[model samples]
Target: MSSPVTPSLTYRSPPGPLHATLLAGTVPLFLGALLSDIAYYNSYQIQWSNFASWLIAGGLLFCGLALVFALVNLVRAPKKAGRPLVYFLLLLVMFVLGLVNAFEHAKDGWAVMPAGLVLSVVVTLLACVTAWMGLNLRSGGPA
Candidate 1:
């Protein structure tokens, strides 16, 4: 009787393009939430009670979902790991910081926050723009 042959046990690498784009998609989505946090970081002087919390919470939820989806696709098909990974990591940090601000805001009731309200506008805008661009890339042609 003849012996059966076996395939190579080494792991093969997939094309990098797919992972690149997946990373790219994470950007705009993360920004969507991050930007919202910035917009509402400190409305206490503006004296809008709980408004920042509401906006940030909602934004985070949406962005978080989008980020997860993007990451998942990258994992499943790493060819999409574009620049969005860097952007996503940065935005993720901003989001965490925003949440911290939210906690502080709750105690102080919008007392300019430790970092002040400016963070809200800047971060929020950046997040929005980045997330938008990232998502837009996903629907484009030619990878």
Candidate 2:
């Protein structure tokens, strides 16, 4: 009987401590933003309030903080990592969407809310993908 052959695969560890922390931290913030939005819309009618304002502000602040972490890692790392770069870009896009959402709320434009919701979902998904990539990053250490 012929012995079965096994396929070999190389394992790669995640990024260093700082990068890993930043990436791990971002995922919860993204989920929080999504959940906050969902909770706000579900419980309240179509009207703005201090609570809604603060909820959004907090979410954006978290995203911004996470972005800073990613950006610092991108700049300080010996070699530029593509995942951090992509994470930075996604954060920027999410920030733009946040601006649009804020403007739409301020303008009392109910019609644009659907677009805002869709954008939020997209941003959340992208954030997840970015975090996943960050989690898979090979630690830039001596091999």
Candidate 3:
């Protein structure tokens, strides 16, 4: 009697070290910005807004590099149908919103409070979600 052969499974590779590092870096910078925004909202201190602006810039730099890597991976991936696509799109949204948040932070005085705070919250949440998904989800298929 012939024995049945087991099927081979192939799983999507995780992001490279640089990509992973960039993704990881976004969270803290954005979170710091959010915290700074909150402090500014409560304390009315101009310095807090300055801190938030700088943090948001740093987050943008890291996120933009990660976005480029995601795009390259999506293009190179054998099958472009699932998590990679979602990750790219989500990262794109996060970057755009982060840019908007940066613009909001550029405003002077009390004008930066409510809108800046709102944008910071949204961008920070997006950063967390993208970072989690980018690191954890693996797309699998036949070899």
Candidate 4:
């Protein structure tokens, strides 16, 4: 009689509690940071440039925290487990873009606001994707 085949194992390990926490926390943390910055701008004589700075700072902080978590998890994982270095590099790229966008927003008028908005969206999406990858990587097995 024929039998069903099972998948083979590789150098992957299931994500642990820390992975779960980091994965789930990243989005909310970013959103909260962004919202806080927005709310801070509600005062009189609001300076969008300042708001941009706060937003950039918030995004960078989130990325930094996420990178640290990924590094720690990767170190603890089995040698066969895939490294999350790509995510780390991507986060760094987002950080640089965020800084650039912040500078654009600091310029007079809203001429570059559209570009800044696009950068913000991209950064947020990247953060989510990176976190999701971390969450799933926890259950890794041999390639």
- lDDT against the true structure, per candidate, is 0.49, 0.57, 0.92, 0.57
lDDT of 1 by residue, 18-96 (tens): 4334434434433443344355453323334355555555555555555565555456543444444544564566567
Candidate achieving the largest TM-score: 3
Q: Across residues 20-54, which tens digit of lDDT does each residue of candidate 4 receive? A: 66555656645543443444334322464455556
The candidate with the higher TM-score, 3 or 4, is 3
For residues 98-141, could you state the per-residue lDDT of candidate 3 as single tens digits? 99999999999889979999999999999999999899756655
TM-score of each: 0.54, 0.59, 0.92, 0.59
Error of 3 at 118 (Å): 0.8
Off by over 4 Å in 1: 1-47, 113-116, 138-143
Report clashes for each candidate as comma-separated counts: 27, 0, 0, 13
Q: Given candidate 3, what's the lDDT at residue 14?
A: 90
RMSD after Cα superposition, model 1: 10.6
TM-score of 3: 0.92
Clashing pairs in 3: none
